[model samples]
Target: MTGPTLLADLVDTSQRVGEHAGRRTKIARLADFLRRLSPEEIDIGVSYLAGVTRQGRSGIGYALIRDAQPAANVEVSELTLAEVDATLDQIAGASGRGSIADRTRLLSALFARATTREQEFLARLLLGELRQGALEGLMIEAVAAAADLPAANVRRAAMIAGGIASVASLALAEGAAGLSRFAIALFQPLAPMLAQPADDITDAMARIPMAALEWKLDGARVQVHKSGDDVRVYTRTGNDVTAAAPEIVSAVLRAQAQSLILDGEAIALKPNGAPYAFQDTMRRFGRMLDIEVMRATMPLSVFFFDCLHRDESDLVSTPAATRFEAMTAALPSELLIPRLVTSETSAAQAFYDDALGRGHEGVMVKALDAPYEPGARSATWLKVKRIHTLDLVVLAAEW
Candidate 1:
C-alpha cells in the first residue's frame, strides 16, 4: 500500500509552481503532484495547490499566526498531508470559551512540527497569502490533466459541484461517468455567467445581431434559488447571502415556479424607481446587522434576466431565448428586467440609452441562441458601457 503523502512534498511543488512563469509548466507540475496523491488526499492536495486550506478559514488572523509561529522550525520534515489536515480541522473547530487559547496552542504545535520551508508555506496558507501562480483555472486544468479527462468536463463539473477540490476527488476516482452526475440543483449556487466588454452599442449589436438587450444595473449580481417555500440568494462569488437579504428571499418565495434558479441584480431603488449608486446598494446588500431597519430605509428591488432552472427542468444547456421564456412564465413581468430583442442597431441603441437614463450602468447584449456559460466571460454576452475619460495628477505613491 502507498504511504501517506508528505506536506513537505506539496510545499515543494507549490514553490516550483510559483517559480514557473509559463502556465503549461505550472499545470504540469501540479498535475504530476496530484497524480502522486492517494484517492483520499486528492481533495486536500488540490485545495492546497489552489491556495486554500481544506478547513477553509479558521478565524486565525495574521496577528495570531505571527504570534503562534515557533522560534525555530524543525530541521527535518515529519508532517504528512493527513496530519496537517487533521491539525487544521482541530483549529477550525476550536470554538467557545478559551477557543482563542486552544487555537493558539494548536497552531504553535503544528508550526513547531513543520520544517523551515514547511513553516513558511503553512504561515502563508493560513493567512491566505499564498500567491502561487496556480490559480483556480490552472488548478482545474491540472486536475483534468491528472485525471486524463477533458478540461471542459472538469470545468463544468466544478461549476455545478461548487468547488474544484471535491470535483478533483471525484474525477480521479470515477472519471467521466462520475462527473456526469453533477447538475444544476436548487440551493446549490452555480457561478454566475460573465460577459466580455464591447466598445459601444453598435459594436455589441454588430457582434451579436438580433441580440437580447437588458439593463446592466450597477448593483450586486444575485442568483436566487427557490424550491417551494425555501428560497436562498447567492452573490456573484457564490456566497450565500440569504440571511443578509430577507427581502430577496421573500421575493423568490413568491415566484410562480415551485423550483427555480433566477439570475439578476439586486439594487436599492429610490422611491421614484431609479437605482441608488453601486456603493449605496452594496452597503444595504452586504449588511448583516439591523437588516429590517436597512430594508425599511433602503428597499431592494430584484430584476430577473435569465432562468437556469424551472420547476423540474435544468436549463443551463438551454438556449438564451428559451431560458428567458421560462423566466417570463415563472416570474412576474415586473420582477423581470427590461429587455428588448432586436436586430436593428438603432433600436438596440435606444434601449441602451433608456437604461442609462434610468440610472443603470449600461446594457448587456447577448446572443439569443447562446447557452449559459457559467464562470466564463463568454463572448456570446457582450457588455456595452459609455466610457468616460478623466485627467488626474498622482500626488501619492506607496510601495
Candidate 2:
C-alpha cells in the first residue's frame, strides 16, 4: 500500500509543521501528508495529527515511556504506520491480571526497535503532547485542501459525522457529494452545541427578545438516542453512559416517539426530591460498578430540554421553539427540564433568581427561533449565572 509509509514520515511532517513560521506552509505540509493516506489509514493518521491515539488511549504514562530504554542500532524508517498502530492497539487493549506488565513488555519491544527520533515522537504521541502547532482546526483545513472541498462544507460534515477522519476519507474518495450524506443517526453523536455566558439576566433577555429560559442544572450533559427497543445515552463528549443510567433508558423507552434523539442533562437527586450537589451527582455519574446498589440511595433523574431528531426526521435544522415543542410532546413532565418562555426582563431575572435559590447553577436563555448549531458556542444560547466571575491577572508564579 503506497510503499508502506513509515512512522518517520508523519513525525518528519509534524516537525516541519511546527518549524515553519508561516501558516500556509504548515497547512501545505499537513495537506500533502493527508493526501498520501489510504482509506484504512485515515483514522490513525487523523488521530496522530490531533495528538491522540485512535485506540482511544495507550494506558501508557510518562513513567512507562521514560522507563523504555532506547536502542543502539537505529532504524529510522523501519516502523510502518500500521505496524506501530498494531503495537499501540495491543497495549491499549491489554487488560486482566498481568496486563500492565504485558503492556510494558510490548512497549519496551517497540521502543527497542524505534530510532531515537521515532521514540521521542512515540512518547509525545502516547502522552498527547504533540505540540506541533497543527491541531484539529488546522487538520480540518488540510483535509479540506487535500480533498478540494470548501472548508465550511468539510467542517459541517465533520460536525455531523462526529469524526474528521471518516469525513476526510469520504471527501478524498467521494469529494463534496460524500460529505453531504452525513445525517443524524442513532447511537452516533455529533459534538454538543454549546452556549455563550451572559453577564446578567437583563443582558441575556435583551439578546433574545422572546426567549426560553431553561433551568440550567449543574449536571452531566446527555444525548439520548431511542429507536424501538434500542436505547443509548451519551455524555457531551460522546462516551456511552447508558449502562450507568438505567432510569434514563426506561424514560426513553416510555417516550411517545419510536425513534428520536433527545438532548438534556442527568442530575442525581436526594430523598427529598431536591437535586444533590454537582460533585455528588458526578460521583453517581461516574459509578458503573455499584450503579444498581447506589441507584437506590443517590438516584439520578433525566431532564430533556432539546430534541435533535424525531419521527425519522432530523430536527436539528428546526428552530428551538419547534424542537422544544417536540421534546415536550415526547417526554413526560417528570423527565422534562423546567423552562419558562417569556419576553419580559423581569420574568427572566425572576427565573434566574428562582433557579439559584433552588440550588441550581444558572438559567439558560435561548432564542426561540435559533437553530441548533452543533460544535458551536453562540449567542443564540446564553447562561445567566447568580455568581459573577472576576478575570484576575497573574503577575507571578512559583513552582
Candidate 3:
C-alpha cells in the first residue's frame, strides 16, 4: 500500500514470522503468500520489505535493489508494494542488457498496475531505503501478511526469494506456503576503518602493534564517506566539508565502487596542478566559512594511502597489506602515497635519505603486518628527517 501502511504491514508480518522462528510449517505458509504477487506487485511489496528488513529483525538483503528517484510525472512522495515489486522485476530483467525503451515499458507497466498506495511503496523501494521497520526478515513477513498469509512461513521463505519481485510473485502464487523457501540473508558487518582520535595523532600511534610514527603534514585530514551515488567529505572533527573541495568530492563520486569510506590528507596544489609544500596547504585549513577565499588562495590535491571501507566491507581489522592492496586498486594515480617497503634498518635509513632529498618530512618505516589502531601513539612507524636544531644564544629575539 502506501509507504507508511506497507511499512506497518512489513512490521506486523515480520513480528508474526518472528513468533514462530524454527517452525518450518509456518515459514512455508509465509513463503506461499510471497509467491502470489505479480512482477509489478512485487515492486510495490519491496518498499515495505526494505523498511522492515532494515529495522534489526532483518538484515541488509535489500542492497541488491538499485535505488531510483521518483517518477517525473508523479506528485506522490511514497510507494506501494506492487509498484516496488514491478520495479524490481524491471531492474532484474534489465540487468546487463536492457534498452531505454525496455526501461520505459517497464515503468509504464508498473504505473498501470500499481494502486496509489502501491505506487508510493514502489517509489520508496526504488530509493532503496525505508525508515520504517528497515529490518530484512521482518519486512518479508509484513509482505506476507499484506496478502492474507502466515508471517512465520515467509521468514524462512525469504532466503530463496531471489529478489523482491521474485518474492512478491511467489507470495501471490501459493500464499504463505510459497514464501518458505527463499535465500534472503542478513546485512554484513560494518567496514573496518583505521582509527584516529580528534584529540591527538600521536595517541593513535601508540595503539599500533608494530613501528608507527607521526605524519606531520601541514594539510587537512579527510574522511570520504560514500554510499551509492552520494559522496560526502568530512574533516577530522566530523564536520561536513564537501562544499570546499568540490573537485575532490566529484572525483570520489565518479569512482566505480558501491560504498566506502577513505582516509587521507589533502594539500594545496600549484597552478600547474602539481602538489605544493605542506606549509602552503596549511593556509586553507580550518577556513570552512570563507570557502571562496580559501579556494582562490590555495586549492587542494588529495593523497590517499589508507582505505577504511570498500564496497560494503569494513577493513579495519584487516592487515595493512590487505588494506593497502584495496587502497591501491581504488585510488586514482595522480593522488597517491609514495610507499617504500624495507625490512632492514639500513634500508629504512636509505629511504629516509631519499625522502629528505625530495623535500619530504621523512620516510615512515612500518611493520609489514600491523593492524591500524586509533587513539594510541607509539613507534610502529619510524619517521626520519634531516634537520639541525640548536639554541644559538638567542641570535636575535624579536617578537
Candidate 4:
C-alpha cells in the first residue's frame, strides 16, 4: 500500500511520536502512519506505538538484549515489517536445551543487519519497554481516525477484545462491523472493573445516592467463569488460577447457574470462623502440592460480589443491583459476600465499622444503577479504607 513499509519508518515514527509533548500531535502523527501501513502491519504498528512487543517479553530478558549490538554504519531500510515480525516470532519461540544459545545467535544476526536506530527500537521492543509517550489511549484514537469510526466503538471493542492489537487491525480494515463481533466468550477473562478511592462513607455516599456497600475482604480478587460443568478462576490480572484454587473451582461447579461469570474474593478462615490474615491466605495460594493439607488446616472461603454474566446474558450492561440480584439467586449464601443497599449515613457507617471489626480492610460503596465499567476507575465505586503510612528501611534478611 505504501512502498512496502520498512521497519525503519516505524522506528522513526516512534521517535517522532515520543518527541511531541502535546497528545493531539501524537495522535495525528500516529493516525497518519497507520493509514499508510498494510492491513497485516496494522497490529504490529499498534503494538509498537502502545509500547510493547507482540511477543510480550517472552523468554528474552533485558540483559540478553543489551549484550547484542549493531555496527555504526548499518543498513537502515533493508528489513520490512513482516521480516521483523518473523524474526521476533522465532526469538520468542526458541526453546529446549540449546535454545538460549540459538536465541542469542538469532538476535546477533538480526541486530547486525539493522541500523543503530532499528537496533535501539528492537532491543526496547524485545525488553517490552518502548519509552515512547504514545500508549493505548493514543493508539485507540489513532485507530479510530484511520478507520473513520467513532473512538467509543473502538474503545468498546478494545475492552471486549482484551487488547489494542486485534482491535486496531479489525477497526482499520472492517470498521465498526468488525468491532461489533467482539464479545465476552466463556472462560475468556475480560478486564476487571476497578474502583476509585474515597476517604469515608459520607464522602462516598455524597457521590452516589443509592450505593451498594460490600465488605472489602483482605484477600486475593478472583473472577470465576462457569459454563455448565466447566469452571475456571482468574486472578485480578487475568491469569488462570483454577488449578491452584480447587475449592473455588468446586464451588463454581456446584453453583446453581449453568452459564455464568462471577467476580469475587477468596479468603482463608480460621477454625474459630474468623478470617485469617491476608498473608496466610496468600501462603495457601502459593501452595500447589499441599492444597488438601492446607484445606484441612486453613480452609479458604470465597465471597462473590459481582456477576458479570449469567444464563446466556451479558449482565455487565445492567445495573449493579440487578447483577447482585442475579448473583444471589445463583450462588449459595456461603459463597456470596455480605452487601447492603442504603443511602442513609448511619447505616453506611455501621457497615464500615462491622467490616473492619471482622478483620476486613474496609468496605466498598458502589452506585446501585451504575453499569460495570471495566479498566477505567471512577467515583461510581468507592473503596473507603483506613490508611497507615509506613516509611521503613530494610535492615537485614536471613538467607
Q: Which predicted model would earn the best TM-score?
A: 4
Report the number of backbone clashes for model 1: 0
Instruction: Kindly list the per-residue Cα lDDT of model 1 for residues 175-223, writing each as its tens digit.
Output: 9987887777787788888999999998898889889999998899999
Top candidate when judged by lDDT against the true structure: 1
lDDT of each: 0.89, 0.85, 0.52, 0.84
lDDT of 3 by residue, 138-182 (tens): 445546665666654554344323334446556666665666544
Q: Compose the digit string of candidate 4's lDDT tens values, residues 273-388.
A: 67888898998876788788888887778999999899888987899989999989998898888988898989999999998888789999999888886666666889999788
Model 2, C-alpha of 222: deviation from truth (Å): 1.9
lDDT, model 4? 0.84
**How well does candidate 1 match the true structure in TM-score terms?**
0.81
| Candidate 2 lDDT tens digits, 1-399 | 277778888888889999998888988998899889887777688778878777766678866775665556276559878888999888988999988888888888888778889888888888877899888778888999989889888887877876676688888888878887786778888789999998888888777899999999999999999999999999998999899999889888999998989889999977666789889999999888988898888888999899999987899889999998898898788888899999999988888888888888899999989988887787899988777579999997532
Model 2 lDDT vs. the true structure?
A: 0.85
Q: How far does residue 207 in candidate 1 sit from its true spot (Å)?
A: 4.5
lDDT of 3 at 364: 49
Worst 10 residues of 3 by lDDT: 184-193
Better of 1 and 4 by lDDT: 1
Clashes of each: 0, 0, 111, 0
Q: Model 2 clash pairs? A: none
Model 1 pairs whose backbones collide: none
